[model samples]
Target: MKRKLWLGAGLSAAASALAGIAAYAAHRLSGPTAALKRETLFAFTPFETGVDWEEVRFNSVDGLQIRAWWLGRPESKRVVIGCHGHRGRKDELLGIGSGLWRAGMNVLIFDFRGRGESDDSICSLAYHEVGDLHGAIKYVEARLPEAQIGVIGYSMGAAVSLLGSADQPAVKAVVADSSFAEMANLVDFALANRRLPPRPLRALADQITAQRYGYRFEAVRPIEALIRYGQRPLLVIHCTGDTVIPVVDAYDLYAAAQGPKELWIVEDMPHCGAYFADRPAYVKRVAEFFERYL
Candidate 1:
């Protein structure tokens, strides 16, 4: 009788453990569910720059409808695709997009899959967001074949931009801002940001991630893409005081870049806060970089 009782308890415990793992995995896989709407994404739309803007949509490689805005400046031959940070919507990139527009470039600012007015889904971080960018490039090429194109991305968008540029030859130049070297460190940051302590569930998380995403987090690396980028006028930007993504990643990417590349480190600038620290310098450098390449 005691043996049977022990066996039942063990089975119950095993079932509970499996249940806990599945629950945690689902929550992590689901990611953040909230996102900004179109109006909110463009609250300051038609930016003070007075660029006429129109809402646009593009289908991702996987057929997800991506929400975007076209900031068209009359007779602008260059188009800069502005990619926002993780969990950030299209409107948040208006400042940067406007800067590019003022520099005599048109801007296409869009939301990644899970953020803003984009298709409803969980953020894949950069795993599949790369497809979103590829879709954007195709959309631009198909609609405006005569214009030169470039990409300026923030955080996750930066990583995806680099990855996309590796495959999209039409992307003339790239500006990757505050991007992570690998997705593993990003997972750690995500947990810490939520104040969740690291635990032994890492293996379970990895398994779950692989099962759902069809690739391990370690494989979603941007360094490989940067290495393949080979002397293509790449610009890597990072802030010294960025607590989210360490500055070391920037150094690694700069060292790994085999082509014409520039790395800019801002003192005391937080993550994605390069412009916030010194708007004038940021504007001048970025505009010049694009002008030099695109």
Candidate 2:
């Protein structure tokens, strides 16, 4: 009986330790990390590309300040919002902004909360970032009431734009690149990459995440958001070589879109590498998409 009691105690302690470790990992994954906060030059910029731009700032619904660059004059009614990927800054979208600027479209590229010059806060991936994107749209609407707005987003930003624009009539079109279908899939992917089993740990992490962050992982489904996004033309782009987000997500998004939609599956490129794969073609295709839909 003594030996059995000791074994039970040891097993309980081990289970507690595992749960604690999972909670810590979940917190780190869902919050801002150094990589997500780091300022890195991963893409060509509007400055280098020679486009007219003005620095701007706006506030999220939760009162977090967001910094952005307006890449064209207010004279044009066509506007596109550029949303960068996870671990990315607004500078990374400047190239795309510059392209759209030349296409006679106003572009707004902003940093999500806890990134670039924005206020420091936890990143709930696409969950909290939806407010930030909505803030950008409000800023643009106030600046140009007659504006026809579209969105171009990469990875997490892609997810954010989809979620933010679902009920927003102001946004008319969306180009989502390398976006995940579900938040749970993302968590599972991370777990699989680490060679960890995703069963109980994933559920435990989700519970801990909701308790700590005030948002459930299941609430961040862009696939479901697309279903609610009515009549907005969608262009779902993903690379075949994207390991971060499966190409099947593109198919799911395309199927979920309620309006006119198009899918572009690029050949053998990494995550969000469609732009770098063929700059001119990518810009032309995306600009034409906004022109047609927006």
Candidate 3:
């Protein structure tokens, strides 16, 4: 009887340990997976070969050095700053940048910290990235004080733009694609999609980010920013088939935003592929929107 009781206790302890390991693994894998695959997305063979581009670097307010490219006609006065998504470098944005350049707009594309050539290996999503966007805007302002400025951001980049636009009044127009309404919602979606149990682990991740970054993950709400300061010409685009970040978040952002705002729901496109799926339509719609606003 004594031997049997000891065997049962050992089995119970082993089971508990296994369960803990599974939970930790699931949390790490699902919480914040990088969406961009550099080898898969950055092949330059398909794009225009001889486009004008100059490598540039600048300093952020926090002293982080950022690397980017300036594309299009060098003497063009109209400019649009394009912010790439989390895990994505500026190279992935060249397709859209090319279109904007053809439309007579100079384009600047850069990576957020930790993603591309930028300094630092930590990303606080948009909570810290907004500061980077502010730094980029300041860089543009110093060079083109009299030029009208527009911004286009994707996913995490979009959230950063929404938050940054609230603080910077010089931005003439804003475009966000497949953006999340809140950072916590993104965490929750990622967890659920991976079929991971999300009780203590999710809470722990939030706690860790807050303790390290001095801001709660839940507090980085882009919908709230839209409600408060989405006054300029805004274009919110999302795809119905965006499994990574739900389309509903874009709807929520559009509903909260006031003034000259429009929401475009692209059918059958996944995540940020709306532009690639229909290049002509995407360019036409975006160009028309910017023409009306900027």
Candidate 4:
């Protein structure tokens, strides 16, 4: 009887420990992330790319202030919005924005809330950030009533673009680079990679995350969002060497998409490494995609 009691106690304690660890991980995942140093990562701006830009600010649906840069004029009628990835700032997208601007499209790059120059908020891992992207679309529509908008996003931004613009008719095309298909699968993969117990922990972490942030990990499914695109064009870009998000996700997204879609899988590049691999090719492909579709 004593040994049974001792074993029961040990099992209870172990379960409690696992639950605690899962809770901690959940908070860390949904918590505010430290912003990267913009100047260090991006040495140049729109000026260096020979485009004139304006500093702009808008508010998200939830009333969070969003800071952005508008490159090129509304007269272009075609606009491309650049969405940066996790912990990254608008500065990181200047290169892509400059390319789009040179391609004769107005470009808008903004910092997601809780990242840089935006209102501080809990990072719901692109769930709530969808509102931020919508705010950007509204800003574009207001600036250029005849604007045909396209979106190019990397990693989390890619996921946001998929979710945020699914029902938005203003966005004509999307280029999703290194986006995850589902948040739950991503959490499972992340926990497993860290050598943590994934079964119970995954569900528990999601529960805690939802309790804390009012959003569930399982609810953000970019794969399902693709079905809503209908006849709109989508370009899924991923690298075989991407470790942050499996290249399989790109394939999944492409398969799930119902409309006119294209998938480009590059070799020997990490997450979002395709741009750095060959800037000119990357720019040309994206610019041509927008020109053809938007």
**TM-score to native of every candidate shown:** 0.85, 0.92, 0.84, 0.93
Q: Which ten residues in a row have the lowest lDDT in candidate 2?
A: 38-47
Q: What would the TM-score be for candidate 2 when compared with the true structure?
A: 0.92
Model 3: CA > 4 A from native? 1-49, 212-214
Candidate 1: minimum summed lDDT over ten consecutive residues — where? 33-42
| Whole-model Cα lDDT of every candidate shown, in order | 0.80, 0.87, 0.77, 0.88
Candidate 4 residue pairs in backbone clash: none
Instruction: Report the lDDT tens digits of candidate 2 across residue range 1-294.
Output: 999999999999988976986797677757644446875445445668798888899999899999898888657789999898777889888777888899889999999988888888877778888999999999999999999999999999999989999989999999999999998988888778778777777898898888877788899999999777988899999999988888888998888888999999999999999999999999999999999987
List, residue by residue over 3-107, the lDDT tens digit for candidate 3: 999999999997675466544533342233243224434445214545777877777768788878887566766778888887677777888887888777878
Candidate 4 residues lying further than 4 Å off, grouped into runs, are 33-44
Please write out the lDDT profile of model 1 over residues 1-294, one tens digit for every residue: 999999999999976775576447535543654632334633666555577789899999999999899988668678899888766788788777887878888889988887777887656667778888988998999878987888999988888888888877788899999998887766666566666543435455666767765667776799988767767888999999998888898998888888789999999988899988888789889999998888
In TM-score terms, candidate 3 sits at 0.84
Candidate 4 displacement at residue 257 in angstroms = 1.0
Best lDDT goes to which candidate? 4
What is the C-alpha local distance difference test score of candidate 2? 0.87
* Model 2 per-residue lDDT at 10: 100
Residue 157 CA displacement from its true place in model 2, Å: 0.3
C-alpha positional error of residue 179 in candidate 1 after TM-score superposition, expressed in Å: 0.4
Which segments of candidate 2 are over 4 A away from where they belong?
A: 1-10, 32-35, 39-45
